[model samples]
Target: MKYVEKAPHVDPVRMRHITDEALLAELGVTSIAEARPWRRPDPAWDGPATIEEADALIGAEVDFLDKGRGRSRLYGFHYLRWMTPLVHAYRETGDARYAAEWDRLFRQWYGTRDQVEGDWPGLDVIWYSLGVWARSMHVTRAMAELADEPALSDECWAMMMKTVLGGARWSAEEHDEFRHGNWQFVCAAELLHVATLFPELPEAPRWAEIGRARVLEHLELDVRADGGHHERSPGYHGMVLDAVHRVLALDPSFAEHPRVRAMHSWFASLVTSGGWIPHLQDSGVVWPAGALRRGAELGVRPEPGSHLLDASGYAIFRAGHLHTVINYGPYVGHELEPHSHHAALDFVLSGWGVPLAWEAGGPPSYDDPGYYDWYQATRGHNTILVPGEEYTEDRKAGLDLFHAGQHVDVFAGHHHGYSARHDRRIVFVRDEPSYWLVTDSIDADAVWQVHGLAPWKPHGSGYVTKNLLVVPLEAPDEVLHGNGPARIPDPATGTAEYGEIHSLGLRRADGRFTVALVPFTDDPPAVHLATVPPLASPQETSVPDHLRVAIGGIVDTVSASTWARADVREGWAADG
Candidate 1:
């Protein structure tokens, strides 16, 4: 009993399976072979106190999952990731039980996994390039980690050596099956791992050459010029960055590359004051503590500030303690853009020590009922949804104008998502009574929605997350359609009830809507709609620019002009 972690509390049901024999009885599989995919790996496995304890627990789950996960490369990759910790545990404590369990699980998985299951494909989906490449790397890593002991049996050692050799040869020779994004990077990482960790191998130098070539080439093509994963999800951004760091682990010189530097800086810029990312695509509010810390450890430090990643259409604005991110489309090419939300012009803000405004929900496990309908749908976002059409997701979105001033900063962007075009402007006031003014202009009938963080309630004329307000300027007393619950980003779980959705609908017939996103502490100021000359523009029907915000005995004007630039003032006059 050399290795034991502090968090031993497992589910009571899981705790019951304390022995391998009990696991066989529980799953009705006399041998682990019959268990096959049924006793599949859980990447989330907590190292068991003993190998016997995990056998039954692994069998307790995935009863209904075996058939569904037949071709799941993702599942196989996760299974391998779970093994590293066990190897680490054995290394730390020199515990025979931990080593024995790692050996047993490796043998069990290697023997039973990848058995063909009704597949008419080129490779078994379960163990194709992705899984095979991953398994090869894990085998190499395990061999390295266990160099000090006989943790691996002679038979297992030989089998894993064969795997590492084949994977490295595959990477070296031009089999040329197209790979991109994290997949390509992972191959590059595995090649490096094979090269540096096992340099004694005959082909290690060649593997190193190929790995470096792949890393530099794909580093340019896959990562956006503005330093984001071209796939538009911060989760994948981390994945790609992880691959980069893996290379850096073997070769410290790669840190000097401009692309690597920019990626780290961009990642750091996207992190909010709360450490969470206001991601647009398949991402959550979870703070990437480990990744950020690793990026820092790599010696490529982030240039801290607000950045307008013009290429990716990601605009980050920070003033004092408030952080806001506005996402306009053009994230990547059409196919690569699949994970991005259709909510261009959508924004999320964190201020007053909590999330004031939030996006729709996402990082969905494909298990959420609202994944497609609400989370990815255009209506699920803060942008205006046209009456008769779905916004054209393929259209190019661009930031037409941008100005960052001392007291005020404006970001104006437009897209041809709708036939007549959809334009949005966000004016952030950096001074007292800090607020963001968002105005959307669409030619035809449009419907829009707004969301505040959860546990929000009706205040004087707005919905408040703590003390921050999301109030429409049309009617000062109405919090739109009244607050309701919607899926919001969960920092811990990816989806939580922390989102209080005040879905305010304003059709063109009812006039377009202007929203005042006000952040406050202590007591919130009363927001009101003020009278101003209507500008000749698309939202001339809506008076967002006419919000006469009165805070701290001062008045600010918010209005928009159509044909000409409206005198959008960011000043506060004395409340005389």
Candidate 2:
């Protein structure tokens, strides 16, 4: 816990040399100080307004800042994103009054330091507080140009250093109960970067070195070879990489690490066609600015047409011609993490300056049921779901493994609402240029039913109006439900299509049943396939397809079945 005292001040020459080398290598350029062209010129704001405009935004933020009541005050991290624009605007306008207001807000939140006590309030605030502080550094030079407040600058630096290093102490926990795995590392990395900036400050050198080592270690274990963060949320993955990139840029020692560069490439690969990241595993709304900046800095580009988004939506790897946004995976890293929700295999796609197919936004507050419930439900994501249940219980909200050339994850345990039954597996594979997802479930007891839909619709319009499919299972005593008409039976296949189904529906065709639901719309409708099993699987099973499938195995009697097939169409029809 001891920090280095009386550490030597970093030499300006050394700092510049190291910064130049890192930036040069990162951008793949011969020089470090060159300014890259802005992706878009700053939009013209109307005639400059006084502190009133700034106050209006702040007041609006305050109105929304109740414990998860509105968007602004859900968590400290959320606050940081909101605060960034304020800090930047205030710095740009050279408004001392606005700056004074910012200082007042900061003090109001953290002044007594009493609120910074537990995991929910204190640690959460600190985590985002570090981000706000880090972003403030970018505008610090701007602020310096407008004002002669050396005292304010020095005070900000000292306070940030203390807060960052202090947060690192809580990161030692290995459970989700205390910290998110990715956020923990983010805090650590940012702390190290802050420390490196002011080496002469107390404990700066020692804390920096320790934090750096810890972050690298975690990166090696958590970041997969395919560039997907192990935790499986593209949004959170981007955030973690952003923090890492900051530290790497600040310190030259990380410049040569392959993992650091690989992480960047991994993020670029996951972007969707709409300029949004794939909502894999607990992902939520996120801006593409950080990812775009990271891509530009790292010289990593997405392969042409390899992403779901168009060129503008995708981050160009090699050239500085296009703006790029990277997705940080969801959830902070922690062992047996609890913040882990049922959001397995989620992504946020963006285009231009807007997000396409964004994960539903959440406030940082934990008080609202919408925030907590959505965070824990599979309904909020673009994934497969079993009929009549949520996610599994045991492994439902924990990271499986994210290393080597493969990335594997499971959403078992409690989140599924089944304390006794277990039969579900969601797997995502990235072999470059192609992404494969497989959902397999087994039902031996036959006590449950399985179904599927194309686009995920939580509301009524998406179901009745959108192009979706509903396949029903008809056991002797079981009933089937389709969206539109009551139960229009398919005369040819003996299966019912109550609504306008774009694809084929599988009903009690033969003794065994299988259905393929394809959406005629842009993206496929979110589907859920469930089965009633008499017994649990003795082993795991694999189903290959872009669509979602789920199986409801009988309590403790179900097991998964594995089959190898070259094509998705063949695999779906092949007998096990």
Candidate 3:
């Protein structure tokens, strides 16, 4: 076999920095001798395999995509892709144990007609196979010692060719690189890596052209000009950025591409000072520290704007001590992408680096039956929920009004989450201290059951009045505990303190509901609110939609003493 020369710029040290450590840790082995016996202990592994029976063909008949059987089979696939760390460990330790185990595992997985020729089953299997091939290529090309092992080297070459050809063929037939978002990114990136590793192959140049074109196409479509991904999920945005970074490591030509730079910039902008991005869709609350470090090393600049990602449909507005995210983008979920939520035009609020109001989280898994029905429903968000109606992604949410000025910040949009056209208007004043006033108007023939939810942490003495919910921010810990969608401290073990999120709600059958959020502190300049009555005539006064009067002096007409809902509502956060 003719040994192809590697790209001079392709260095393993650079690739190792961006590698998926969480995934590698999933298949950790205490010793190289145990590598063959370290198959993931999944019941789907042909009804479970003891250590002695590790190499047995237990997964021959299992449908790996079936939910009940998926996790187990998925774990087995992780073991197959463990070539990444195995090679890394071998290089670091200079141990023959690693090489012998790698040879054994490769033979067990690929030596026979039944093992290699069996049905590849699903896209996930193909995806995992591509991952294995890429890692194996990296090992062979970078470590000449591994490639010079005569017999083992020949076997590696055969296996690499088999997997790459199969993956390329499957990719061309099964996926349209231009259409599938994240999947194509992975496939194309791997193809490019393979092409760079082996220039002597007949299919090398074609792979290079197609892979480069496909990846650039994804960057054009999925990444918006404003430096946000079209999916509008912070997690996926990070995932795509990492993929691009890996490919750029192999081909330095893409390093300075405008789209590539913009993607990284978007990632840097999404992160908060606390090192977390608001969990949207499948994204977790905290961005990976390693990815952030790599992004910084790559010189990803956070673009300056009003925190508005117009193309992707979100704006993070900041004021004195407030950081608010408003979702006013198109339907993020589509036929090929359904990972986003029915959270159009909804707003998430945080104050002084602490979350104040957010969602309570949805179904844990995508394949879970309740995912589309319940968690993705409108009721799962911190927005108005119409009874018996679910928001569908078919109807887009468009922003009808927007203004950001020195005195006020306002946004209005309509969503077809129900039979009625739900028009919501939100405005924040730049008073000494700030508060938000939200007005929701519905237009329909039939009477509707409407309510607004403000899921906040019960930090201090607070209550849910008829048209208002007040939560006092006495300390920062209360605000920290309020971060949601992705649990902060995590909810499962109860060991962490920041994951719990509580709800504050209002219910009214009327077509219009005006609500106010008032903030209280131990110091002066306390936040207060009042409902401004409809004027008898239109005038040129710049009076806000509702009133936010700092409580020190003046008539105080809309005082807390005169609140209409003296009788607190049921299930109020403070009462709970």
Best-fitting candidate, scored by TM-score: 1
- Per-candidate Cα lDDT values, in order, are 0.60, 0.38, 0.50
Q: How far does residue 360 in candidate 3 sit from its true spot (Å)?
A: 4.9
lDDT of 2: 0.38
Model 2 C-alpha lDDT per residue in residues 1-576, reported as the tens digit of each score: 222121223322111112334433432334322121111211111123445556665544342234434332344433334444444566567656555555554545444433443334334433443444343343333233323433233344333333333443333222122233675566566556556544544445666666676777766766665555566555567667766666766765675676676666655555433344433444443334455565667666644422321211212211111122222123333443344455433332233322222333332334445555553554443333344554543433322222112221112211223432223232222211111222323342222222223223332111211333323222222333332111222223423233321111122212232232222234434434344442154233333222323312211111232222222211111223
Query: Residue-wise lDDT of candidate 1 within 60-116, one digit each (tens)?
Result: 322222545443333553337655666656656676656566667666655655453
Weakest ten-residue segment in model 3 by summed lDDT: 29-38
Off by over 4 Å in 1: 1-65, 69-79, 116-124, 127-129, 172-180, 289-301, 331-337, 367-369, 476-511, 533-547, 559-576
Model 2 stretches astray by more than 4 angstroms: 1-53, 57-82, 107-110, 115-180, 252-255, 286-293, 296-339, 343-366, 371-374, 379-391, 395-441, 444-513, 521-576
Total clashes for model 3 = 1
- Kindly give the number of clashing pairs for every candidate: 6, 100, 1
